[model samples]
Target: MKKIILLLTLITLVFSSMPVNEAVAKSKYKKISVSATAYNELGRTATGFDYRKHPTAKAIAVDPRVIPLGSKVYVPGYGYAIARDVGGRIKGKIIDVHFKTRKQAIKWGRKKVKIRIYRK
Candidate 1:
């Protein structure tokens, strides 16, 4: 029984010491042009995460066909954000960024921006 326990402990240690694959740890992204807008809604996003209490400031609404949900994206003027929300008029190549206030959202207005989207 003691020998069996020691072997099991050794096996566990070996498995835990193994390195994770770099490819799996890193994400590959593609660049695309999108029309960007801003919003300040304080409710839950389409991902079921509260917009007011989300962990990252990088939250944006995206069209599923253009950029899938949960994708990490880097918007030029908006910085880095995750595609966590969607909108009715946000179809095609349009994206909506989230802000803390309506004034900030309005300040962004509408413009064309280059965004890098991570491929799942």
Candidate 2:
């Protein structure tokens, strides 16, 4: 069990470091372009994920129709995140990325970005 867990962790780390284009090639997925915004909220997410405590968790809010809930997403500059939450304003191809700090969120602001989505 421990070996399997370790192997899974190792695989996640390795895949996460892979370049965007390569990851798309390796995975059964869809690469999409969307509007991305950042947030640093101090509460539980729609998925009941305690993102405030797990500050390093790469969590994203999305419209389930576009990116299904619990899907893994790769944002170019933001690294890998899971689609775990949703917002009233987050409809269509817009995604909300969570950051550890307000400054980081502000720094990220909003941008048009291409992201790779993988079904978990």
Candidate 3:
């Protein structure tokens, strides 16, 4: 009857709309060092950097295959970071923490810190 046809059609539509994971792939998880920096308030005026731009002590680099670019990460010692850049200077599982001032950056300089990757 009409009711039976409508139910089947709705079911088919729902299933078809479900996400197929063929195109996008998941990143492999890994633990790595992370650093922190605190940026000056002036640096954040133009682009809303305070909220969006990586925090001065919040920028970090990660292995692209392991963490991917633009991923949010939390550091055990330093706090939160966004994987923004890859470094020739930084190799293996190392991460560079950014800060607003030289003093703040230096305060956190070159510490071995654990990082947790936040999956979106």
Q: Give the candidate number with the greatest lDDT.
A: 2
Ranking by lDDT: 2, 1, 3
Better model by lDDT, 1 or 2? 2
Task: RMSD for all candidates, in order, please.
Answer: 6.7, 12.7, 6.5
lDDT of 2: 0.92
User: How do all models score by TM-score?
Assistant: 0.73, 0.76, 0.52
lDDT at position 7, candidate 2: 100
lDDT of 3: 0.60
**Model 3 ranges off by over 4 Å:** 1-30, 33-57
lDDT of 3 by residue, 1-120 (tens): 999999999999999998877435544445665443333232432213342354434666555766677778887766777776655555566666655666876676666667777764
Q: Weakest 10 consecutive residues, lDDT, candidate 1? A: 49-58
Q: Name the regions of candidate 1 deviating beyond 4 angstroms.
A: 1-27
- Model 1: what TM-score? 0.73
Choose the strongest candidate by TM-score.
2
The model with the greater lDDT, 1 or 3, is 1
Models sorted by TM-score, best on top: 2, 1, 3
